[model samples]
Target chain A: MSQIFHPSTNTLSKVSIVSVVLLLGGLGYGLLALNRSPYVARTKIPFDQPVPFSHKHHVAGLGIDCRYCHTTVERTASAGMPTTETCMSCHSMIWTNAPMLEPVRQSWATGKSLEWTRVHDLPGFVYFNHSIHVNKGIGCASCHGRVDQMPLVHQENTLYMEWCLDCHRHPEKHIRPRDKVFEMAYQPPANQLELGAKLVKEYKVQKLTDCYTCHR
Target chain B: MKRLPWLLLIGGSMLMMGCRQDMHDQPRFRLNAATDLFGDRRAARPLVQGTVARGMLKTDTALWSGKVGNKNVDQFPFPITREVIERGRDRYNIFCSPCHGLTGHGDGMIVSRGLKKPPSYHTDALREQSVGHIYNVITNGNGSMMSYASRIPMRDRWAITAYVRVLQQSQNVKVSELTAEERRKLEGAQ
Candidate 1:
């Protein structure tokens, strides 16, 4: 082997300096790349809002139907939010003085929409049509965490793409009656495997096993 | 290792495609239901047919009123139960309560907002209406009321009519003669 020469003290220090500089350059590049592009994040973002609302009270306590507020869910792509007027129609007379409800009243008076914290959010690339899914009898609880039992609505589910496609690939696993849409802690029915299998066969639901469908 | 990684990636990629057409070959669940029993031939069989034989015997012809379309043809057979009532209540709350109000009093939130108030269930017109007529209204939808026939099954509508009657009776119970003990209980004498 060719003899590797021993360096002088100054030369050795220079090598160390170069190595440290290179390592730090690589690290700085990584962090800058991370900060610049949003791709490095491991968690989904939680949105903030003006007022806190509870699905638990209406759905669990009073048994108010899910369709009452999210009216267009069964027939339209977007489940329309409760307009300020919808709140004022009831809250105006029912809980006229509740401080939390003041924002709703204010929004109504100003003819402005409430900046409701979106609990169930999807990525911009993912095209989720609430109407089509609901019309096809896919329960709301299939994706949304049990909204009926939640007090201050937050994104209870991680809503990862994999979590969604799991059901899209095998909808039979999540098929249920339309009424159980808001029920939390609900499990796939006892005969779920069998029923899901039947639905899979009957509806001929094609599993979305393509990458481009999501990435695009 | 390269091949393994490539295969997994391909497999995972494949899972992200399609609308769920894979499990078609899986054995389907068989339910012992009447509807399923005749599932294959349901379309082949006619939905509603009236078979009538004009009387060769002359004296049997008699006048009829109210529902007189076909006396010779048998009435439709339906079984009403508590389960159906519960199911109807659930379905009604979801669909009907939006317009008709929770108590069927025409005071629902939608009505309060702008929608028209539907006919009261407490009225004698609704109380004495046949289950079939009520079913027709639900299926065909009356006035501003949209049809729920598609969303609610045939049996549940009958159950809803039954529940409506219960509501009417609750609202219109007349004060009548009571036994001594019953009167005491009514008077809260305990």
Candidate 2:
């Protein structure tokens, strides 16, 4: 028998490739584990909106509901932005001729969305469902902070898996009416901790601590 | 050697899949839905589970109080109230009013634009639902709605529930107020 060997890839290059691959793999795993644990509060989201909508003016003064502009939030994937016409509905008739509000008025007349900058965006790899949280009795302030006070909305909470699981672990204490889903804390029923724990247990919230919850 | 990477990738994915339960069909929260819908027989036993009364299921009760150690709610550092409701209402109108309408009739402009309108709050099923149940819908949202859980507060979510109840009641109230004599008695004028 006669043996002939022909190699396209060099041994030296293959060894170098292996070493590089190992180094990269170690770095990726390290980052993965670091991100696994929750990071609290919004050291992340640089939230800013276009129109600078004021919850104080609308809610405190006019008595609007959180669902009004973010309409589809109760049943859809996005807690949708109000259509330009939605703003015009009232602004056109109510503020009808206000000079300062002309931009909003114009947007409504033209049918363009507000182009609001997302303040509390979790990663694309993350999965978030509003109906689940709303149904689970979670509030808005749990992630967005006290939005009523903000003239221009900012991401108040970190929205990490830890932030979400902490409450997923106990829904009743944090659970309240559907409207108050955005509340900062569980005030009513006095013993929020106790109540939250009760809801979690009652609902049997398990593996909320599991990685696949927020992670895809 | 060429197929080793493929084998490893497939193996790793299988391992990850094996660690988790079936989340795809997990029973989501629904109005007036039984706690046992998720099949936790132990948690479903008590006669009075809705209230804070504790009996056999001590662990679930602890989860209610935020004493579950590793797991807790992300509520404010305080309790929820009407103030929270007011704020939530403001946001809801700005965000939800377009589709849900002011009264939650699900007949917003979008519906008029040919989007499907939702059930009216005046419906008996929705009327019978709890405020907490409605809040869950608002936060996690329903069929077409998105999670305002990120934008609205938990307390304000409850407030919206309160308001929705008001709408429901207004639309379906007894629809028959009593006479002056009964009204006087109700007011304690006697």
Candidate 3:
């Protein structure tokens, strides 16, 4: 042995043990942080669009109905995006010369569509239908949040699988009268559970937990 | 040998991150993205000739087209029920009420904001027109109005036509022709 190793070697081994433990703890935290990050969840982050259309100004300020622009929500699978014709139907007269609306004006003039960036984008495999949800008395505010309050639209909820399952498992907590679907300020009454049960039956909402329901 | 387990743990975590690429960057086509698989270089395939999609046969001329031959049918293809009228009211309020107003006065919120004014349903011109004529306008559109054929189904279009007639009658009713029950209600309000 002849004193070949330094006396500090004993302390060095102890330090290495502590470092290994800390590294494992850091990895666990990093995974948790990534899941909650804005990149993955995308809640409350306004995405950039070709035009900065404000839902607040149109919906809250002017009292325009959501169906006024998203015209096919009640009838089709997709809540159809407004065409240039829809924008020009109002902007052609009102705000005709505003520089802020230049992209809208150009789209109208060229007969080209404004490439709007989608906010609440689901993965390709998710089979979400706007008509089924809307026709079943699920209000616009149920998933979209208070869109009328947002100056620029943003995804308000996590829109995760767990979040959707929470509502699907207990739809009575969320269901409302069909007439109130567009009402952004609608609140579930004190007897919401009773009302929801009645609506769940009336709308024939089945408890959808099968993987094929959403995945297919 | 002591450091080997530590290195393996770090490498394993890194490998887990790489595995996420398969689901996120899946082998699939974006909507309307260009593809070389087809001669047209489009990802979407054109419908085959003589192939009809489900529920889109359009064989019923009066039901689907609002016409029998060249003329618009004077009556609804199906009987107009109370439930049908309510559905029509809902659809009309969502679609037509933006331009035609809830009462078909052509003074909708859009018109107040400066879109072209539609003709009032109570006008002599519109009131005298056949039910088919009104349905034709809704199916094909007329003047500044855009065709709602795609947005509204055939049954709903008929329902809306029925509701529009009800609106016209409401505004153009004669007091003398009112039933005794209706007259009593009107006098009670006074």
Largest TM-score belongs to which candidate? 3
Question: TM-score of the candidate numbered 3?
Answer: 0.80
Output the better candidate (2/3) by DockQ. 3
Ranking by lDDT: 3, 1, 2
Q: How well does candidate 3 reproduce the true complex, by DockQ?
A: 0.25
Question: Docking quality tier of candidate 1?
Answer: incorrect
In candidate 2 the C-alpha lDDT for residue B123 amounts to: 77
State how far residue B101 of model 1 sits from its true place (Å): 6.1
The residue ranges of model 1 lying beyond 4 angstroms of the native Cα positions read A1-48, A177-179, A182-185, A211-216, B1-92, B95-120, B124-190
Cα error, candidate 1, residue B84 (Å): 17
Extract clashing residue pairs from model 3: none
lDDT head-to-head 1 vs 3, winner: 3
Worst 10 residues of 3 chain B by lDDT: B24-33
lDDT tens digits, residues A103-207, model 2?
Answer: 786566564334455555555556777777665666766655666666666666556666677676655556665545755443567777776667666655553
CA displacement after TM-score superposition, residue A192 of candidate 3 (Å): 1.6
Please give the lDDT score at residue A209 for candidate 1.
67
- Candidates sorted by TM-score, descending order? 3, 1, 2
lDDT by residue (B108-141, candidate 3, tens digit) is: 8878876778788888988888888889998887
lDDT of 1 at A39: 44
